[model samples]
Target: MTATTRSNEPGKRSSSGRMIARVVWMSIKLLIIPVLCVAALIVGLAIGYVVLGDKPLSDVFDFNTWKHMYDLVFAEGG
Candidate 1:
């Protein structure tokens, strides 16, 4: 009946170790989800650019289109 009494049980020590390991594993999965989502979004955008070719992006960003959109959104009146 002493403090060293518990240390003598190998099964208890192994079970505690397993519990700690499971907590660490669950924390890692929780942190990985958001990082994985951002990575997927960046990769998806890159693939979209390549698949869409170059012309469409150029048209989307064209000066007249930008001016028209800007004017529509920010103009003093509709």
Candidate 2:
């Protein structure tokens, strides 16, 4: 049997460990999109709640409220 020697390289990582790290990173990257979308939805709902301050909380989800807000923001000035 022959003796094996290991190098003391500073940045050396095992192949399997590197693969596992890559997969974990990819998973986080994939999950971030949906997380961001949900965050945006919550923020939009908060904005709608403020816009419809006197109405019920559930009313923030109403299509009419969104439509009215959209129109107010995008209406052409005459």
Candidate 3:
């Protein structure tokens, strides 16, 4: 019988599953940045409305608030 040699290098991953898992984790990390940005935007709007705008916290998230702002910015009186 002939002897065969199997190379087992140190720190080299032999399983394709580990590579796929690493790729999936990287993708998840990349997607988190945009989600965090949207969250920060919502928090900023809420804080601005409550502090600078002096509006109630409950009204900060109301649809009418944004609708009014949109209308004012696009007013036709110019």
Candidate topping TM-score: 3
Residues 1-78 of candidate 3: C-alpha lDDT, one tens digit per residue = 999986788776767868898999999999999999999999999899999988899998799988999999999996
Model 3: residues >4 Å from true position, as ranges? Answer: 1-16
Could you give candidate 2's per-residue lDDT for residues 1-78 as a string of tens digits?
999988779799888989999999999999999999999998877776777676677767788988998999999999
The residue pairs in collision within model 1 are none
Q: How are the candidates ranked when ordered by lDDT, highest leading?
A: 3, 2, 1
Task: Give the range where candidate 1 is weakest over 10 consecutive residues by summed lDDT.
Answer: 53-62
In model 2, the worst 10-residue window by lDDT is 48-57
TM-scores for the candidates: 0.43, 0.60, 0.71
Q: What Cα-based lDDT does every candidate model obtain?
A: 0.72, 0.86, 0.90
Model 3: worst 10 consecutive residues (lDDT sum): 6-15
TM-score of 1: 0.43
**Candidate 1, residues 10-72: lDDT per residue as tens digits?**
555677789999999999999999999988886665566557654355454367865886789
Q: Report lDDT (Cα) of residue 52, candidate 2.
A: 60
Q: What is the lDDT of candidate 2?
A: 0.86
lDDT of 1: 0.72
What lDDT score goes with residue 20 in model 1?
A: 97
